[model samples]
Target: MHTLSQLRSGKLKGIKRLDLSCGLTTFPEDIFSLADSLEILNLSGNALSSLPDDLPRLKSLKVIFCSDNQFDHLPEVLGRCSNLCMVGFKANQIQTVSAAALPLELRWLILTDNQISHLPAELGQCHALQKLMLAGNQLQSLPETLAACQNLELIRISANQLQALPDWLFSLPKLAWLAFAGNPFCPMPPASPHAPAIHWQDLEVAEQLGEGASGVIYKALWQQENPRAVALKRFKGALTSDGLPQCEMAACIAAGEHPYLIGAIGQVEHPDQHPALLMPLIDGFSNLAGPPSLESCTRDIYAQDQYFSLENTLKIASSIAAAAEHLHAAHILHGDLYAHNILIGPENETRLGDFGAASFYTPEQNLLQNIEVRAFACLLEELLSRTQGSAATLDKLANLQISSAQVTISARPLFSEIKKILSSL
Candidate 1:
């Protein structure tokens, strides 16, 4: 939230990052003054429509965020910035993307909630690309050139006009996280009859539980005959990087009941008709790890000193595997199977949460399940890296990790098989 006055006065010089969001309409020339030190520039929540041609003068810039702006097209000069690797232009009027706008060293690109209908084939030139966010756009199909992105790990194509996903996407060497709900090819499953409707007036909202990209969660008290404490999730009614909150709600309901999954107890519709979910309140739990950092890119960040007992590691992995098997049986893909989404409770209990990236798939699309297997493998590998136990038990877990991460999608063991093998160990 740095102001133009402070920037113009040169008081913010020698900074590695700069954030300006005071209704700016044009690029500030003073920004170039910190070109030697500025590595990140955030101009989100502004009125800017374009950047100056000399934006490349910021030679140290590695990331730039211009979300919630008025840009209609990506700036071509971005391609000339050799050091720039991450670009975020979400929620803009961007309808055109020139091939020259893509940096060759790009690792992450976000163009969500835009009017983009086509993408330049030159995207294939970005061999280092990993994370791509393109939800809430008008894209009907992806360029086949994207298949060359072998390092790509996560992608979001939800809320787009996509007719079908390319088969090659399912075989990417590193592809793991994926979401494609709200597209023509993937219709959400019908509302679950098992999730009974609970009037919002019957619950008393308490302190906030937490918030994520799509919604706000709170602790609530269900004021029924047998009153009980419950968790309430009220969607923000906006398109997230994953997809619509409504789509997530649909996936949560479709997921039904599972021992390791956070199930929806009832559906809630406020007097104004805002949709919400009543869930069983989870007590005394914490996230297994933090989300990926700028350096880790696609991996979760665990505590440096964190170490799990071999028995606890096996239990956590087994619980998650059983839950994943259940989800696949119900024809659902938990697009995000990362450690950060797994909440660890007392006695080594684990519960998988966050349906924001979940999507429905047919049983025939086993490749999708295989893609998730790679994610599960990564989770297992992370746990193994933190555990020390009997060589035999550790060897078994390592074997499962290796088999689950096989480059050949069909070679990966199913969650059911993993669950069984884990139980046997």
Candidate 2:
């Protein structure tokens, strides 16, 4: 969060990070003074539409974020940076991406909430690309050359115009987390006619609980239900990178109830017709881990001092797997099943939540469930890295990870089977 005054006064010299949000319409020449050391640069919330062609002079720059800007196209000068690997230009009006706009060593790229209809074929040349976000766009199809990116792990292509899923996309060896919910390939699910409706007038809002890409959760009291304290999520009522708020609320209602899932009491009937959910207030529970960092693009970053026993970790993992199995049986896919979304209670009670990425499917859509299994494997792998348990126990988890992450969809074990394996440990 360094200010322009500090940067101009040379007080931020030798710093590895610089964040400027002072309504700049042009690149600051003073930024070059710290070129030798700056590794992360954030210039979001500005009016700039382009970057200086000499951006490569910042030889150490590796990550750049220019989200919420006025850029109509990605800057082509980015490709000249030798060490640049992570580039984010979200929420822009980008309609075209030139062939040279991609970096050579790119690993993570976020072009979410844009108007891109086509991608440059040269994107396939980035052998190191691991994570990509292009959810809210008008893309009719993906570039076939993207199949060459064998290292790509997580991708979000929701809310797009794709009429069909590319067959070769399933063959990507490292793809684990995928969101293609609000697209043409998958038609919108019908609203649940049986779910209860709780009017907004019958509730009293309290303190804010938390917020995410989809909405804001708040602590509230249901005046009509014995004044019970509950959680209420008021959606942003706009299209997010994953998809629409209506779809997420519908998925939550369709998920019904499960021991390891957050209880969705009903939908809020508001005068404004804003989508909202009435849920059970999870007391004393917190996220098990934080979202991934710029460096660890696809991995969860747990608290450094937080340690969980192997038994507790296995219990949590089993609970999540059981809940996922329930969803699969209901023909629902919990697309964003990661530790960052799991709530950890004092006694290791687990509840898998956040239906923003959940989507409905038919019993015949077996591949989708297997795809979620890979996400479970990622969580299991993260837990394994945190625990140094018995040789046999560790070896068992290692093998389960292998089965869950099998690039071949059929080779991955069913969530039910994975639950059994975790229970045994």
Candidate 3:
């Protein structure tokens, strides 16, 4: 841990990685030239307004953490870093990204909590890019060029000024996880499902996992025979929408005994007449919506020593697909499917949870009438969000050959298959 004053002379040649977060106000000149062999550098918690122009000279540099700085613009020299893959510039004053300033081999680029209002179209040239975060910016639009990135998996643009999402954004093939909360273009609709209620005195609540449109989930220690840990989902009376309780109950029962599905332990009715569900607690899991702040996503991803791996994402997708197939086979429809509803368990096991909007269908029912088009559109949006930027994967996920007007057919078969099973029943 070196300070700005100590780094003035560039005497730390032996150090492969350096951190100058203590009382630093500016970056020393020729810092990168001196540290030719540096692989990682941390200059967070500083007052620097901009980076040195010759920063790309550090050919061995791979990772850079410059969060909490005062940078209003990204350094033009960043494009020269051929070996750089990860760059964190969260909590800065940046307002835009120039197309020419992006590195070609960059895999992960985070610029959360900045003032960015637009993205350059040339960013599409970064074919090797995988994850790009621009949360907490002033962005009202996105570049259409992002469709060129074939390997891109995650693109977070939450809490911005976007009023309408571009049509091409939904066409990315490999794009998987997305969060656009607090955006006027895709506001959290008033159509949220109802949540069951739980009294404070009935169960001992531990840590709060998160809150959703329907209810709050808590890691609780139930006072049972063995005193086991479980996830307690409690609903707020005011937030309860029509048919939510019955839908949730049906989903819990229909999910049944699938390994990838979270087992419903039991249900408890409170004095207030609200119902809550109890299930085994799965650790190290987080919702895909992430945090409301884009800076939070950048900080989490840049902390590579602590974040989830790409392999974990694949496991989650596989498990969710399996669970959805099971529901389809049982003549049940998971009315909602997104990252927030999926959980990652021990040994990277993906478990599907939150069945608040699930429903059962019969052969006589029309698929178009039975499934809410708005809800189905939301699910398709979620799936398309994941496949964005990868033409091949997008084609596979959306099956573009089916035509945009008939995209609903992808989900129609699931219900059609279920209807056939119910006919025999």
Steric overlap count per candidate: 0, 0, 14
Q: What tens digits encode model 1's per-residue C-alpha lDDT throughout 1-425?
A: 78889999999989998999999898989999998999999999999998998998999999999999999999898999999999999999999999999999999999999999999999988999999999999999998899899999999999999988778796687888999999999987777777777887898999999987778999999998899999999887678778987788888888888889987786787898787878889999999999998768899999999899999999999999989999899888899999999999989899998988888988778779989999999999999999999999999899999999888888888998998899998
Cα lDDT tens digits, model 2, 1-425, are: 77999998989999999999989999999999998999999999988899999999999999999998999999999989999999999898999999899999999999998999999889999989999899889999988889999998888888889887787777787777777788877887777787866889999999999999778999999997467999999988567666777777778888888999985888899899888889999999999999888878888899998777888878888899999999888888887888898998999999888888777776666787888888888998888888867888889999999899987877889988998888878
Report every candidate's CA lDDT: 0.91, 0.87, 0.60
Strongest candidate by lDDT: 1
Worst 10 residues of 2 by lDDT: 237-246
Ranking by TM-score: 1, 2, 3
The whole-model C-alpha lDDT of candidate 1 against the native structure comes to 0.91
Model 3 scores what on Cα lDDT? 0.60
**Where does candidate 1 stray beyond 4 Å?**
none
Which candidate wins on TM-score? 1
Error of 2 at 392 (Å): 2.3
Could you tell me every candidate's TM-score relative to the true structure?
Answer: 0.97, 0.95, 0.55
- The better-scoring model by lDDT among 1 and 2 is 1
1 or 3: which has the higher lDDT? 1
